[model samples]
Target chain A: MKNNEITDITPKRRLFELNLGDVWKYRDLVMLFVKRDFKNSYKQTVLGPLWIIIKPFLSTFVFTVIFGMIANISTDGMPQFLFFMAGNILWSFFSSCLNGSSSTFIGNARLFGKVYFPRLVMPCANIIYNTIGFLINFVMFFILVLIYMFTGSNVHPNLCALLMPFILLSSALLGTGCGLIVSSVTTKYRDLGVLVSFGVTLWMYITPVVYPVSQVAEPFRPLALLNPVAPLIETFRYGFLGSGTFPWQYLILSFVVTAVVLVFGIIVFNKVEKNFIDTV
Target chain B: MREMNENCVIKIENLSKEYRLGAIGSGTLRHDLQSWYAKKRGKEDPNQRIGAKQYTKGDTFLALDGVNLEVNRGERIGIIGTNGAGKSTLLKVLCRITAPTDGRVRFRGRIASMLEVGTGFHAELTGRENIYLNGAILGMTKEEVTSKIDSIIEFSECEKFIDTPVKRYSSGMFVKLAFAVAAHLDAEIMIMDEVLAVGDMRFQKKCIKKMRDLATEEDRTILYVSHNMNTIRDLCDRCIVLDHGKIVFDGDVEDAIKIYLGSANENFRALEYVGNEHKHHADRNDLCLQFVRYNGKEDSNLSKKSYHCG
Candidate 1:
């Protein structure tokens, strides 16, 4: 194709065109980043990857004391420990994706300044690595669910549990979308970095992670459902505990919103990736 | 004489890049506020008009301006210029790391650049992992990278510590691994920017040999940028000399160096070099004479040996 013709395509369409072909082409590099993040995450730590389990376990325990016992928050008839652990695991995944993707541009500014690669690859690799972390955390959660089952709690395993993969993927897409947008803006106006850290923390309160959606009386119920993360977590809790309210409409809305945000994120990200080295 | 039928791989037409002078910080805020006050009074902003005039003064500079050039496939082209002559900027634009403010650059085939050592390496990863990572960053497929992994590790000679995190590797080993990964990238156009200057002489020689083999055996288009004139003279078939953002010479390697050294005379008086927190004349004082101004008198040139010190 001619040079002008090449430049004519929008960066969004260009990124979609890049897809697996470009990713596969750089598969070795992605693995390197994955290896780097994984190895570095535990390097010099006394317990190494065990900290992965310990971190979420400690958070769940602390939240159960503060929110479940102290605040007396209702858990939609599920065991307090299982309820809090589920929320903690899901929140960790979403927050990690947002944090990882948001820092993608700034974190790699040195490499970006000197080299040319699909800038998308850095965040993509981060998501993959963080997903591995999520998987490890999920296994720990699974063990907890087994313990709850033996304790005479009503923990039914439904066929719908098979859809947890799709739920996790949706959560990842939502996080990636939000993260890319934040990263793109942060490249120009660094104030967004500070804003995102506080913003994501406040965002968790709105999601059904700490409390059940049914507790939010009617008019505010839809408002809580508007959050894409709310549906993903609710679905996870529903598939396992068979207690929390699951609205298909909200799930569809979440999917649609995730797709749109992802497209917009990629567009802005592609444009910034081209010349951010200069400005950054 | 017949026209050379060698296929051109890269073409630049009237390329230019402009950078704003002065610190782009609080100074801009004061200027903006002053302009706003002037506009409120229904008068032209005095600072705005004065600022425009100051930019037009000779003090302002262009990094690269209306430079046109071409490189044929399999040709080793050396770009030689003083610091701030837009050499790195040109390479950045060619590699798509930065965009030209104006004009166009057209190139065929994939381009792989090793502009800086350890460009894509993550210190937390092992040497073997970084090999794959850096390979992918250079745009190689996993299968393509897997096939070359053994050779890359062999070339780096760090197989014993391949699984050790790169943060633990010695700087020399790090450079070797980074260079090996860069060298193995399968690209039609390879751009190396002063990476040889940092490593030991033995490794530098190895890099030069690798570059020469790539150019001669693989028929790759190579653009080598370095201040080491001897390396440029020995390796490049043709050279392009850049001065004050413009191409002053584009021809045989030897002739380009001559023109570049010759043009250094016009700018010598105004040139300033800051070295280790001290400012000094860029030109050698022993080789040049200070101005001998006489009202209404024509300037005269003295013989090279008889020239007085500045």
Candidate 2:
């Protein structure tokens, strides 16, 4: 599809057209919502923005102690703390976007009912805020790596690290696509909310966050790779830790799935946004 | 009709919105299951069987029914009605926030509606951020909002708190900023619903002035819904009176107010007040109308008799 021709004309198309130009026109509103989410997420807290660092900091510490120390998990030549932190930060961003976008309609029903802005702006804002949080956490992870290097622990920094932002974007796009689909469905069927909360948690295990993809058994490895997030996370870890197996085929598959899901998400989101206030 | 078309920017015809208020739990599940079952059976809905009581009395209500009206460009129209008279619902339909169930509304230009102050505001956002946000939500482009940002903040009188999170703002300041963004929105048609009631009297005066200026100077169509009859009279060139989801009167401001006030007077008379029964009657007819009080000594004449109408 061309850039300008974003609309799909189906026979089942409802009353109104979904105008992407309107969404583009309302980009400032999207930014404001992003700012609101960023500030309100940590406002009134004693730690303030430090909570962004502290959350993944503590989670990485726990994972390093339990999975790296106690279970003696292999870090594939990279420092255990750095290895797990990278995975945690990446997964945290994706999960946060998913959880936030999934609740978009239900969370803002009052505002949605009173206003007529493109509802896509809410989820788009969520993706932007989560990306910022991920960037902050990523910076902290890098600082921790430098600390480990100063302490004489072996750490290899590779050129692939430059690809971190692209990986983050891919994950965000995937998360946003899935999140919008869930949010749109949840507006009509409230059960989708309950199901998604549990689904995301289970999905994290299937993605290779706790363990390296190399550890998965033979037959199940292909099935695990089939999980769209699995390849994205694997690629992110490979870019950072320089350890995980990066299959180009699975990467292509993940990109295809992300695009398809995103298109479906936008379609469903646009459809629901028009009249979801009534249904909600 | 041709002459009316020249001035009119909005024409709503046969507009009706229906809402189905299903019974509590079992009814929803029953309807869902029955619909699914009927779909599988490849037949018409069994629930639509003859005399099935498709809707119970308490379960259904029509918010609007066959409402038709025309609003002209550059005309300041005030929609006045009592609560639940579907004033807000009509605006919602026109704004396309909610679709009409059975009719169409044809609008000639972009519509910006302030159904309530701060409709999509996030308390955590700063006033400056929210100005752009609110403007964009009202359908302005970022560039348009950026150009109008200074004027919006100036008009709102919220310069000191421009960078502060709106959560810290007092309710009055929040409303002021919200209304400012709305007022500055560059839309052809502006629909305001009691938003001027939020701020202080001075701010209300400023808002009314701005709305008046928009209608006159900018030649924008304005549709205002407010309970403030005096403000309506002062600000609007034309007015519409709605009663029971229908337009009872639509014309020049004076005629509309007269119809509205006349009906209100009748309603007030029908409502019995102790020791004030004869207050509302016109003193024209002696036999048909009765007065219960007289300031002077009573005479034997029927015109001088102080009698209450029975």
Candidate 3:
């Protein structure tokens, strides 16, 4: 019963008070949420977690046939199969992170309404869970690249390949940021929730996931790179397949945009979380 | 700012909450656009319900208005109120589930709330796993829950189904397990919202006994909200009655219940009594006397007889 343990409940805190220490105190809860996500997503399924790899495998096959074979899109002279696989793995991670985190307020409205916890735990769990899936896909992609290399294919991973973790994290941060922003808005207006999945689909096409960024018209290349995800995907392909462009300046620009979005998203999320239950 | 007393465990000043009327987003883009257009013309919000009384601010009304109170340590308080009495809203604000529109509450020590039992239970998770999950959600560390895990399971009386998914458990069993977890929470202040409305009679009695022990033995402060005045009288030494976001009575338990039942008001009349006529209802379980009306006549069994009126 120490008097110094007093906690004040007020209507407004500072706008940028992200309450990171509160989140840190609840780290165990975050891990539990991640564990729950992992368990629930695969439970009772025939393939269980194998679906994570199977998903990318099927999507890569479709993109190779549709974009590489039929549309005859160039892969910057890299093998079309591996090229598509690289983009698919990275893009799926980013998109899933975005879509999953975007529904934080809406999906857990019942849970959020009943109890009090740092609201960021939901999206943090989502990103970590999605990151686990991305790691599995990355392993599968790496094995494929190794097999292709032994067979004397020109595709070889370079020193740039070591930047994969950074690329993955940036994509995760960007997606979670955008998702938090959308979730905050969707608490008041559910139309945004309905629009998120479709919007992510459209976002992928512009992100050079199926085609090389080089194929975009020269004048529009800079515009496409401004997408933040565009350069990250290019860097991923550059690292793994060793054929895509790696514009250092654009990469820096992508990181800057990600930082801005993540910071802004957190601020908006903090503001809404105080009383989002009333509206949500 | 007011000076806080050393013994005061909770202090509130001018607490108020305002909730928007009608729809938060009007449920559709067209309606939102219409509201926006109407606002631009300095007209009433198109989304506002027709003939709804507008408060001082448009389409918003206070749930808790200028409530101020302070509680000393180790006080077992019962909060009684009718529907829409802001009892739940005040608990929500204290638990930090939702922020107040204005004012603040300062409290010492951690607050564990049972606003609703099983707040984060997953259907796919086993009963044992959910105990851990729910414990964590209520701010208990893993080791803390681990140490109390055996007692929690034992208290729940669901030992056989501990490893089974909660979805497979009966509704009664679900509530039993949920209450067990909440009962084990080690916090200085416990805020509960009518959690005993479910479960069997034996279990309800067990819960009441356990809570009484916690308040007396552990010296923890307890604030219970309930419509069951019998339990209130049994557990709380002090009581507060709320109506329309204001405290109507705050004193002895018997007096508070009298005020809540309208027996203390001369103009109020009791239309119905809890006679054996309502005994045939299948849901009737606790038939203890709750309220009585004198009607200017002496009845020795009046306290024993319960009356019902609104």
Q: Judging by TM-score against the true structure, name the best candidate.
A: 3
Per-residue lDDT, model 2, residue B39, is: 62
Candidate 3: residue B217 lDDT (0-100): 91
State the lDDT of candidate 2 residue by residue for A164-245, as single tens digits: 6667777888888898898887776777788888998898888888888888988889889998888877777776556777
For all the predictions, what are the DockQ values?
0.29, 0.24, 0.64
Cα lDDT of candidate 1 equals 0.76
lDDT over C-alpha atoms for residue B175 of model 2: 92
**lDDT of all the models against the reference?**
0.76, 0.75, 0.84
**RMSD of model 3, in Å?**
5.0
Local accuracy of candidate 3 as per-residue lDDT tens digits, A4-99: 478889999898777888888888888889988888988899999889879999999999999999999999999899999999988999999999
lDDT of 1 by residue, B1-310 (tens): 0122337777787888777675332233356567678779988876754545434335545788988887888899999866667899889888877777777777767888889988878777788878877877777767877899999899888899999989899999999999988888788888989876546778777878888898999888899887666677767898887755777677788776554543443334242232211113322321232221212122223212122211
Which 10 residues in a row give candidate 2 chain A its minimum summed lDDT? A1-10
Best by DockQ: 3
Categorize the docking of model 3. medium
Candidate 3 ranges with C-alpha deviation above 4 Å: A1-4, B29-34, B41-59, B263-310
**Candidate 3 colliding pairs:** none
Pairs with steric clashes in candidate 2? none
DockQ (C-alpha) of model 3?
0.64
TM-score of chain B of each: 0.76, 0.77, 0.81
DockQ of predicted model 2: 0.24
Lowest lDDT block of 10, candidate 3 chain A: A1-10
Name the lDDT value of residue A149 in candidate 1. Answer: 85
Write down the RMSD of all candidates, one decimal each. 7.0, 8.8, 5.0
